[model samples]
Target: MRSPTLARRERHDLCDLALVLGEDAPTLCGEWTAKELVAHLLVREHSPLGALGIAVETFARLTDRAMARLGRRDFAVLVEQLREPGLTPYALWPVEVLGNTLEYLVHHEDLRRAQTDWQPRENTPADDDAIWTAIRIGGRALVRPAGVPVRIRRADTGKEVTLRGGAEPVTIIGSPTEVTLFLFGRRQLHDVTFEGPTEKVAALRRAALGF
Candidate 1:
């Protein structure tokens, strides 16, 4: 039977890459090094206290403390911890697929794209389809905060999402991965084309596009 664990596989590969890149390598996640990024992943998955900090402003300090503490641990050990199965609430099947597929994929690219010699990975069609599904399910919220009429189109498959409640929407066209990155507020780094009214497109480009 075919496996239903593609996201888990991606997470494993990301963890392995983190271990290889060492602790001080730059990542697309602001000033976070690979170590910080790995710490974030560990806290995100393993600690409810840390995870709460992600959504609750009041918990921000606790989250930072948790990450800092975790970041001090040996790097390879942390990566191994990330590879451990069923260690967090997010480890369940549908949740793993829904929550982590895009999370890990985006963060994986965050590491790669931050490198000067980076190139986009050749994702399988299955991977694209999975990301597209994520965009269709959760992308609207990411775009809605920008308060603009925006449409996202996948160049490879012609799939599109219209995220506006008004006319004269801005349409962004790219591969599924690129569109996902754009929606996630990585617009400056994503390779995409915008087609719409010049003013609207320009505004959309300048507007903060993600959650």
Candidate 2:
């Protein structure tokens, strides 16, 4: 039997936590509760029109409606469906690993980090490499709007990637997992540190940092 992909592990873990935390538990997806977050995931996988809206702002209303519809289901039902989804692209191993790994990673933390007693979970080197790969590929898009030179460094490996380029590049330093969170807009909750010009760092504080 094939071992589960990172995405599957994250997905299954998130589903487990969501069930334990219940539907109304807080999440980092703005004001969304666990139910809302799960609904969004379901819609992203199952609703053709809403899926487009997941990343595109123009179709947000459609996604909202779809989520609202899904949100009406029992919380356990929603999570179970996500864990054992039928015919969803995320169920396919390749797509699950490539497309959903980082997505679920961030969302898992979205739920995890919201609790008061939350603690940082250590990521293995393999998982760090997986997330680092995602940062190398997708980090550019999330950092581009900042408009300043941006570089991310993995603290342990000393490996680096440039996300956006310009003068006085800001170097974000941390484990890949923390860097991923910071890049994905969970700036305050991340363990990452930065090295850059005072002005550039200040500008980054004010700028929109992620997708």
Candidate 3:
């Protein structure tokens, strides 16, 4: 299956999980309820103003205002809206596959891992491959902000990426999905092994790491 199809399936699974967990359930996204997360997703994919808000500081306030309004609506209603196909401008296609695959995957984990007893989801080989591809394409940029050299190694495939060049280097080892989650600033929640000087590792951990 293609990345977009996988992402779409993940979106549906997220809605289903949101229903099962209830709208008010906590998520890794600080202070955001499941309903709020759904609203963000909706705004991101369907609202041009909201999408612009993501990059342009001038539009951020507007996006936040939109999200606040959307959050007030019924939770199930919001989920249903997400389940429907997105607006034509934002429909899943060429870029959607690459852009949304990691997005939906990470957000899905955000909701699941926020729970006390949650375990890592069992992903298929295809899911693993897709996520690895995402990492190859975008992961370097995500970690570049850390200002320290870093290496990410996939325990399963031995695939690796040196994200930056610096005097001090840190290595993070995990499955592709776990590495993806870590790169997305979910380090505390993601189970991965870190090998490096204590100070360097601490710096890497403290540095903002994400899109």
Task: Return the top candidate by TM-score.
Answer: 2
lDDT of 2 by residue, 1-211 (tens): 9987777889999999999999999999899999999998899889999988888999899999999899778889889999865897777887777788888999999999999888887988888898899779889888876777999999998998988877789998998888888888885455778999988877776677666
Q: In candidate 1, what are the lDDT values of residues 1-211, reduced to their tens digit?
A: 6575767887888888888788898998889999999898888887888889987988988889999899778998888888855656676888888888888888888888887888777788988888888887878888766667888899987878887757888898999889889888784354689888899877776777664
Each model's TM-score?
Answer: 0.93, 0.95, 0.91
Q: Count backbone overlaps in model 1.
A: 0
- Taking the tens digit of each residue's C-alpha lDDT, what string does model 3 give over 146-206? 7778988888888777777666589889988888898889954556889888988887888
Q: After best superposition, candidate 3 residue 2: deviation in angstroms?
A: 7.2
Cα RMSD, model 3: 2.0
TM-score of 2: 0.95
lDDT of 3 at 190: 51
Question: Model 1: residues >4 Å from true position, as ranges?
Answer: 1-4, 188-190
List pairs with backbone clashes in candidate 2: none
TM-score of 1: 0.93
Find the 10 residues in a row with the least total lDDT in model 2: 202-211
The total number of steric clashes, by the backbone 3 Å criterion, in model 3 comes to 0
